[model samples]
Target: DAYGAIRANQGLYLSSWGQLGASGDQLDLTPARQQLDSAYHLSDSLSQSAQDHNADALDSRQNLKQAGDDADDRYGNSEQLSDADQSNARGATDSGGRGEAARMKAPWLHLASPAGITLSTPESTHLAQGRSLSISSGEDVNIATGKSLVASISEKLSLFVQKAGIKLFAARGKVEMQAQDGEMAFTAEKGVKVTSTEGRIEINAENGILLQSGGGYIRIEGGNIEVHCPGAADLKGAQHNFGGPTSLTRTQPEL
Candidate 1:
């Protein structure tokens, strides 16, 4: 109802300043957008249609042309492209140039619901970021999967706790941590303790297990316990127990 305002027969409204109002189940922009990189493409050349799609196209066309440069540029230089292909490439490059004018320009999309916003797909939903991806919540952020949730990283995976401690819990299954090709080290400033509530704690090594404190050390290996210290060695217990007979053997210390 304003100057340069237009309304389509399908209940779609367009403002003079390039704002669109559509309440339809589907609003098609294929007439204006081009899918140069992915299965979907958007371009600004179709400006008479919608300003939003035009701006998006302008923003994406640069990347599309850069991607096309790998193949299209070669075709353009080698004189292998047909006339029709050359024309289309020229058009795409022009549109992409317009897109690069506002490089990295992306629309700010806001979707709000009174209850919740749910995104569900039958197959899979993938997300990628050129820089960093961050998710934060005021109350809580929760991720749930009925089957499996996995993450693969090329560098390293790190989790930092600033307030409370961190917890890994499996209600029924086992929780495992392994360093296949490297060392697995757990260091605590205060102290560290490993406990089993109702089961046993087993530390098995293929070679040996060494407990070292200052200049003293206790080595357990080959079904034998060896203790050595530069100072005094004291063993205090109400009852002295041994699996087999104990004997004193004098030999030079390994350390």
Candidate 2:
């Protein structure tokens, strides 16, 4: 031990120190060493006890919550079963009309916790019978699954992100955006710009493309040659300016 020296000649040895060690040889440190070991052992035992107590408390809380939820579900179902039995007796005496309705009044199975309801593996979960899946959150909700994510809306779907923006990235497959009604609208605070890195950029409008300015009327500036049309061209507006002819300007189209 660093705290003491050992005198050894046989199996039985005594621990002491030279007269010039940290604590002088006249100063016995065996009691101090034993006191330190005892203190450390006591501290470790207390820490372990506290940790075990905390773990047990957490497990007990979880089990209590689960038991309460199960009791609620059972109570609900039992109440419904009592009502159904009465209905069945009444229909058996009356005409056959109410008998069919009694059989249809079966209770749905549901188990809910304070957090949320979870349908276990054997239980199948259906949302509004294919109507819509809506969620309202106070803070944030995250979903992680090992399967696919599909959002199919019949009528209209709207998303509004107030604080941060939304970004969509496709790693492998294509990104397809289609409006069956052929009317799509996008508005941004600054502006909307679309770019392509590798492939060509194509814009197709069944009718035609329209560019209009709200504040100022219109302004067209080209660093080199801006406008290009293959077929026919027409300029019909309140005011039109055919800029000075340069190599890039061709007011006429080929036949």
Candidate 3:
């Protein structure tokens, strides 16, 4: 009768007989339902290992708050590139101190100084003819007579014209005269005439020329004469105006 109650409970019905009592009564209920199904599968494997340790501690606190917000956005972009390199080095030192104070307050029209040629005092004086004047000096240039010296020197001018009456006219221009060095006799007190049409004249003197002429073939004409004497060439009507080697005395023809 169910193997006679598993053979009268062979010590809780394992088996004494009953023909091994229904296979030891189903192996005695399989170890008490396998210890209640291994304590309900060890409480569902400790509740899935406590929900995977609370999802790995919330993914390790969101990866430590995204690594502290990427180190505070790289320390605020390095303090805005260190305040834009100190505002471009203080605006290039305030634009080079306002360009050296506008080049020391500007003003110097024209001046050449070593102790000479610095002229700018035009208030009004008069010497207006063709109007052009220039002066150059390395040394010694004195022209003093109410100062109205005009010039058009194409070349060659050696000066020592004192007594102040310089009206140097050279419509064709050629002059070379020298006298003024210890002064044996230098007189142009108001007279030194030099006129030129075709321009050809030469007068080198230790003292001579009290009126002469030219244009009569040998009467002293048309330019070109040479005279150098150590003693005498005093002519009245002339013998070819006493040619060179110096010797002629015939004075007495001027009243």
Candidate 4:
């Protein structure tokens, strides 16, 4: 009954009032409204999804840049440490070699060799051998041998010869000789003589000095002072002074 009433009303109103409306095309608007609503909803959803994807891509790029910066800092620190270690190792090796050379050149130790020995030193040296001996030094020298000996010195040397004999090859300094129970001979550029001894002493010098012989006679041909005695006598020779008393005098020379 309600549907029949609405249809009868719609037909009466449309016949009277519908003629008063504008036109047929203006009145038909249902299809256009449905199409416009569908297009607007689809466009809004697509725009929202695109914005979320762009935000995720930006976050990923920032993370990668931060990781690259951290790795570079670690590499720079490692290189500095490696260079420091190498420099320390080289310095230790050079210092050790210099220490060894210093110990070898000390003057305290006594050096000896056969077939005539050659020596250089800043201090004194002592040589004792039965064969012919030769010595050289910057300081003093003392030679006591059973046979002939030759000595050279840049400084002062105190020489003692046994019953055999001695020949002073060269001397740049003073020479003092003691021939005990033996005959000793020496030559010098400056001065040479004998002090006190039980044997005979012969000295030849250019500068000239005092020479004396005790139980043994000290003979100096061209020295400053020359003396000959039977017992032990004080002999001042070159740059040396001798002192002592004489013993028994023997007619036959000991050496």
Best candidate (score: TM-score): 1
How far in Å is the alpha carbon of 23 misplaced in model 2?
64
Each model's lDDT: 0.46, 0.40, 0.34, 0.35
In order of appearance, the predictions have TM-scores of: 0.45, 0.36, 0.17, 0.12
Evaluate model 2: give its lDDT. Answer: 0.40
The CA-based lDDT of model 4 is what?
Answer: 0.35
The residue-by-residue lDDT of candidate 1 on 149-180, one tens digit each, is: 89889966644443467888889988867777
Give me the candidate number with maximum lDDT.
1
Candidate 2 vs candidate 3: the TM-score winner is 2
**Residue pairs whose backbone atoms clash in candidate 1:** 34-41, 35-40, 35-41, 58-99
lDDT of 3: 0.34
Which is superior by TM-score, 2 or 4?
Answer: 2
